[model samples]
Target chain A: LAKTTQPISMDSYEGQEVNITCSHNNIATNDYITWYQQFPSQGPRFIIQGYKTKVTNEVASLFIPADRKSSTLSLPRVSLSDTAVYYCLVPNAGGTSYGKLTFGQGTILTVHP
Target chain B: EPEVTQTPSHQVTQMGQEVILRCVPISNHLYFYWYRQILGQKVEFLVSFYNNEISEKSEIFDDQFSVERPDGSNFTLKIRSTKLEDSAMYFCASSERSGLAGYNEQFFGPGTRLTVL
Candidate 1:
């Protein structure tokens, strides 16, 4: 498992773009950068995932640099409903680990009206 | 979208009592996992199951915790003896494939809030 570091909290307003960055200096070659979102009293939901470069989906985009030591989750046109805790994980996606997720404290994003 | 489902949105029990948490994973998912989160704390992985057997577990799983796929559609976690420390939200998740095949994106359930006194 690769340890990840992220901001404790971030604030954003409606219609604004929010970017959260995670640093995992010890990420492994077989590891993939994954992000999850959790609203109050709910389970973590998968947002986006990527191995390298950039990957975009209906909800968000993941940007991984060439070094892969860090990654960024970019959310466009944020709304109050988007307020949640965002987790950045570097899980070994090609080993015998069985895909168990290890979550950190995560970055709490609060969207204002 | 087919999502994982857990039973007993909330459960209250006494210390030393046993409790079973049940989950119905996505119909096509092959891998199942259990995770817990104490209030204001990070979510912690308890165990992972595949092919009706445990594939991995954290130190927290210990002897008190056990998992079973009693039938084709249901997966369960049993705590033989509950402690005050066991009070937390238990989340059940399922994945279509294991890490061995590369992509292993897991879908999570709403979670069971367990309160032990």
Candidate 2:
């Protein structure tokens, strides 16, 4: 697993779009960017993932540049319930990789009223 | 809406005592993992199990730590001799194996908070 850095906290309002950026300068070629959302007292939930370029899901979008040193998770139309810590992971995208997640200090997204 | 389930949301035991944390992974998922987080620290992986065998483990998974899938639906992490430093929130996760390619999303269960005295 590659080391990642993300914001300590972020504030947003309901109905707004929020972007959380994570930096992983040493990410390997085989690594893929993956994001997860975790609410209080709950396990982290998968949000989005991408190898390069852009990937969008019903919940969020992942934007990765050619360098892949960093990636951004875009959550549109955020709600108060979206208040949770978001984690960025560069999981080895292939070949015998299991869920050995090394969670960093996630970005806590606070969506207020 | 399938979810992994963990038992005894909270467990309190004395140091040197054996403790077992139980989890029921999603029915169809083939890969299972165990991770723990101290009160204010990041989550750390303990071990990963598949095909009823240990695939990978972290340095934290020392001699005292073990994982077992006793039945069809249950995956258990057992600490042979718990320690004060072992008190933490332990999480269980399962993922569906999709070939050898990457990008399999792991589904996690509500964690078990283990308190060692």
Clashes of each: 0, 1
Give the per-residue lDDT digits (tens) of candidate 1, residues A63-89: 999999999999999999999999998
Query: What's model 2's overall lDDT?
Result: 0.88
Flag regions of model 2 displaced more than 4 Å: B98-100
In model 2, pairs of residues that clash are: A93-B102
| lDDT tens digits, residue span B11-56, model 2 | 9999999999999999999999998988878878889899999988
Chain A TM-score (model 2): 0.93
Best by DockQ: 1
Off by over 4 Å in 1: none
- Tens digits of per-residue lDDT for model 1, B1-117: 798999999999999999999999999999999999999999999999998899999999999999999999999999999999999999999998887655658999999999999
lDDT of 2 by residue, A1-113 (tens): 57899999999999999999999999988887888888887788888788899999899988999999999999999999999999998866566666567678899899999
Candidate lDDT (C-alpha), each: 0.94, 0.88
Candidate 1 accuracy as TM-score: 0.98
- For each candidate, give its TM-score against the true structure: 0.98, 0.94
Candidate 1 lDDT at A85 equals: 100
